[model samples]
Target: MNYFELHIGDYAEATQHLSILEDGVYSRLLRKYYASEKPLPADVAIVQRLIVAKSKEERAAVEAVLQEFFVLAEDGWHQLRCDGEIERYRSGEPERKAKKANEEERMKRHREERAELFTKLTAAGAHAPWNLPIKELRERVAALPAIVSGDEPATPATGPETLQVGEPATAPATPATATQTPIPNTHYPDTNTQTPTNIGINTPLPPKGGRKRSREPVEEPQGFVRFWAAWPASKRKESRGKCAEVWVREGFEALADVIVAHVEAKRDQTDWAHDGGQYVEAPMVYLNSRKWEGAEVGAMHQRKREVVI
Candidate 1:
């Protein structure tokens, strides 16, 4: 358990009577206990050395904190609060396992649906815009049949039709040689005196504040996609959108091969595998913290795998 919740009010009230040195010693001991997920050793010297209590004052502080906050039993020095937290964590293991199983099943169903859609698109000599979110992709997939079969009206070749969908359509232009009918301005209805130009037929008015620029989907690079596919799916694999953003911002496409190799290597590492990936860093966290440079990943391994691109 590398992480634990500390209630500030509860902690402060309990330790307010202790000196600064004693307070620091108490905090250190609690961290060690939670990290190891066990009670402190029976031997006081061993405990002191673990917290680096070298000086006489430091040693006394350790003793004082232990006396008030912990109880000695045959196994070790146990703190009731720490014990309760450990028990609660263990008790929730079954619930966590079930949740993980459900998520895996949901992902499997999505893959099957996507595969069916891909087949249809491929037959039509088209492919999905993988850059779009799943909801948008699903909608597009459903509409593809009507579009490809010509049952749906084709998009107009030019003018306002060229703009994004949902923009208001205008009256088609009249041929220069033909007689024209005067169409009333529906928007500005009090328009008997206005000329055709004043009707603003060619250009639509900007939406309330201003025209909103269309935001097209951004295509992800092949390198980043491969890197992501190679990365393991775990409980900590979260914030995918933010992770993709960071990958591009950091220009990690150049280091994709090296990064993927390191991730493969770490598949066997104890920290990532421990407690079913409870300690695995989130994808966004791994990129943001630049963990590839950490000593845990060898320089030799990364350098050997670096590509020219």
Candidate 2:
């Protein structure tokens, strides 16, 4: 199952041991003779020539000479094996098993450390009050003044009147001035104006239709909204590790998208109006670490929230 076993024991020695040794010897002898000031023996001269020779036949002849040494030297042959099988076994099953066990223990320790840290963190910081109802959370958030409202109270402006006689007299009229004729409600002939001759004081106004209704104001609940942007709840939970800092930005994106889309499509306007305010806490966005922020919400680009707050 291991590399050495697959290649048969002492595979390197059986296959290329002689050549490998010769290459080493040849290289060393060449370095000592050619690179250094030392002069090689005349017989050793043959090695340098054979190594430099370009022909394959010449290289084979040189290798044959090296093999002769390997055959005669029992110590040399044993040296080539050199605890090969034992070394391979030591590197195999037992070592690998030990290493794997050590790795698992390391991972287990790391997990325990994280869990302990989380326990400490949960103890230190606030826990979302257990099993809080959605209705209650909403109510609490609703009580907050910062929550956006659906409609703003309209403030009437003082502007010019269209020739209506509704101004209070700035100065008292002179008592002896010529009697002024009272102005009557005159009828404009054209347009959608219907002149009513029966202009009695207590005439009820026409049924209150045919006018464009004003848009409702936006309202926000009292508290900040919690939106989970992450796909799985586990990711959200994990990010809250110990003194968890990072929450997924995806959750906030989801909340913002939903709220924005709802508003843009004008859906649930009545419900929103009933709900007190129109604002929803955008999805939970843990930007980098340590803090969660709300996503930017608006009509057109709300759907494309990858990471905006």
**lDDT values, one for every candidate:** 0.71, 0.36
Please count the clashing residue pairs in each candidate, in the order shown: 0, 28
Q: Which candidate is the best by TM-score?
A: 1
Query: Could you give candidate 2's per-residue lDDT for residues 1-309 as a string of tens digits?
Result: 112222334344454644564545544433343332223333423554635644665556445544543332323222222245445555777887988799768656643443333333233332222223334434544443331221333354444543359765455447754575434523222223434653334444444443332333323221112222222232233323221122222222223323333333332433423443333222233334212212111211233323211
For model 1, give the 10-residue run with minimal summed lDDT.
300-309
Evaluate residue 220 in candidate 1 and report its C-alpha lDDT on the 0 to 100 scale.
Answer: 72
C-alpha TM-scores of all predictions: 0.47, 0.22
lDDT, candidate 1, 187-286, per-residue tens: 5422334445766554454445444344433467665687678667787776666677778887766555446656766767657866777777777777
Quote the positional error of residue 291 for candidate 2 in Å. Answer: 19
Which one is best on lDDT? 1
TM-score of 1: 0.47
